[model samples]
Target: MNAPDASDDPTPLALPRVPRLRVACAMQSDTGCVRQHNEDAVGCMIPRDDDPLALAGALAVVADGMGGHAAGEVASHIALRSMLHVYYASAGPPPQALAAALVAANDAICERAGADPACKGMGTTCSVVAIVDDRAYVAHVGDSRIYLLRGTAFRQLTQDDSVVARMVRDGLLTEAEARRHPERHVLVRVLGTKEFRPAVAPRGMPLQHGDLLVLCTDGITDQIDDATLASVVRSHAPVDACTKLVELAREAGGADNATVAICSLQAEPLAAQPDPSIRTTRETRAH
Candidate 1:
């Protein structure tokens, strides 16, 4: 697709004037104490010199694919690449850029699936965190999640859109039971399927100094509770924290493909504003 026309906003569209925020990312899809090949993919993109705003705010993403052979991996790469292309080309308001990216990704994935018979039924779960200025913009589908850590307080920022998540929401099942459900991994929506359009939420509120944000697949969340996960995130460095978190899941029986991406925020050198994602993680308990 062609890039969007440039415009003047005065505010840094090409780059955020803040000191560059650096990130450390890693993905170890170990087929998890089982299986022959891994199907999880995770990535992080920092805005280049041409797009300094992205550097000010970073983009971290995780995708979990499901299908026979290596089809899942292909599905995830296409989705992530499509999103990066759209977001960089358009250079619009943060929320608008994120929304457009998601749509473009969905289309690109579906197109790929249609062209390849081996990947006929392939699909993937996608969750992303875009840190721009002091804010974090999040767009997700399926069960992958984004979490925030502030001091000793840690919380999940995105909601799960899977069958089990919905069931838990409707009070049809308890949180504990949902965890043990035979079909807990069943996702209601994902990328690279026929006629799919995920409901896009707005860019999340901005982050405060000393805040930490994480993105990961169900492989990690399934085996650990929020409190334990939070404890680790608040204590370790972003890279080490993820390593320990994944280790915890393995100890609890890592039953599926796993991936994680982390970003920590400190004081910015440029002008800053209030960020919404900084608020505590919201909860919705069913009756």
Candidate 2:
């Protein structure tokens, strides 16, 4: 018999199913009760099922911009948009790509500032979270933060790069003191400042099922304390939690732009896990 003609069959080949790191996310940003322009920008990329980065990870960012007029808005937009572009386009581990993305964001902002005189002194505080399997990689600068709520304990994972924060770190100021300090808003490190030295965090932080990650600007934090924030998240889904947080902030007489993003990790069964990943030794988690 003659070989079957290949053109006889018109059925499309089925694509293999891909296992994914399950995550549910929600975010909200508002100009708040005072600011006329919303300078804060947020972005995230959940890799497509067929894309290689799907297994490598997903990324989220919150940037609080600083400048006069519309400069801050431009800076934040550029930082967020550039980071998303560079992150999904890069290679290597998710942690390494997260670091590279920050650099690209900084460079893009710097170039924009140089091109526009009105945006000369613009800068932004950037905080990012990259989730890969049971690990989370964080890249942060300025005073924005990433908080983790696992079980009954909730704490900040990203340290603020601000004057008061540094003081608190050095023991010159207590946590409460820093929170109420006169210079709490003075940030020492920020993107678009031309002084950024992006530190690459090795590997990723270990995460567990039922873990919730919150990334936000000071607007949300300055209004709501950690305990209250955690309570809202615990009582509601990510979508409702985000809106509730924003409402709470505005209710507290928020005076600046407020932005918040949350991601919840669902249970991962043992059978679905891939081969064990190597944990980093002597690895430092830098913001």
Candidate 3:
């Protein structure tokens, strides 16, 4: 909520001649100091150099679960898995395809919650970013956020769909007060609701070498300010930036589960080949 007015363009100033760019990515998640279980989930799909979707981009998603205990975890897990699966296989453009994926995930989550009584009202906040060629495409619902950092300019790419956020925008509340407000976590538009609609970025944001795209749950933003976040990312690599950001959130009282994913655009030759599914994080822990 501390970012510049959402009215400003999120696309950074592009270089004169953007080259064949590639993404370097990493993710980290934790239960935090006060939480007994991690309800947050993080995932991504970085395609092979030869894959058709490779130019369309690599996808990264972060979801913050909200129903309580296992129900919340289930909602987030379902959202992550469903989105990634639906996204890669769809043939639509990045913006349209990403929007459809979120809608599908919302339906999937709703269906799961209804079938299981314990998960009756379970829901989650989902934020996704796709870096394709030299452009970044995004779609999200709820308060989980996507941020773009280009050079010294750091901007938030998504808006919070919550009561406190509305008040702040309407000039009824200040950012400082909104952060501490009791209803800050009471989001108005989250996954698992029939009315949930993903807000898709109007167009792909132009990118440049050294540009950094970040996706994270509220835990990280709640505890640290934007200046701090920009500094951590600017000083570290993608993997280390995620680790350091999560650690800082934990140190800052760790009120909820913290999760972070980073995608850095580097001007370099394409790699030979690669493969990784989005659900690896959750499934790995099951072992």
Using TM-score as the measure, which candidate wins? 3
Residue runs of model 1 more than 4 Å from their true location after superposition: 1-29, 48-56, 269-287
Every model's TM-score? 0.81, 0.85, 0.86
In model 3, state the lDDT of residue 175: 95
TM-score of model 3 vs. true structure: 0.86
The 10 consecutive residues of candidate 1 with the worst lDDT sum are: 12-21
The total number of steric clashes, by the backbone 3 Å criterion, in model 3 comes to: 0
For every candidate in turn, the CA RMSD to the true structure comes to 12.7, 11.1, 13.0
- After aligning candidate 2 to the native by TM-score, how far in Å is the CA of 178 from where it should be? 1.5
Once fitted onto the true fold, the runs of candidate 2 whose alpha carbons sit more than 4 angstroms away are 1-20, 268-287
In order, candidate lDDTs are: 0.76, 0.87, 0.88
Pitting candidate 1 against candidate 2, the one with the higher lDDT is: 2
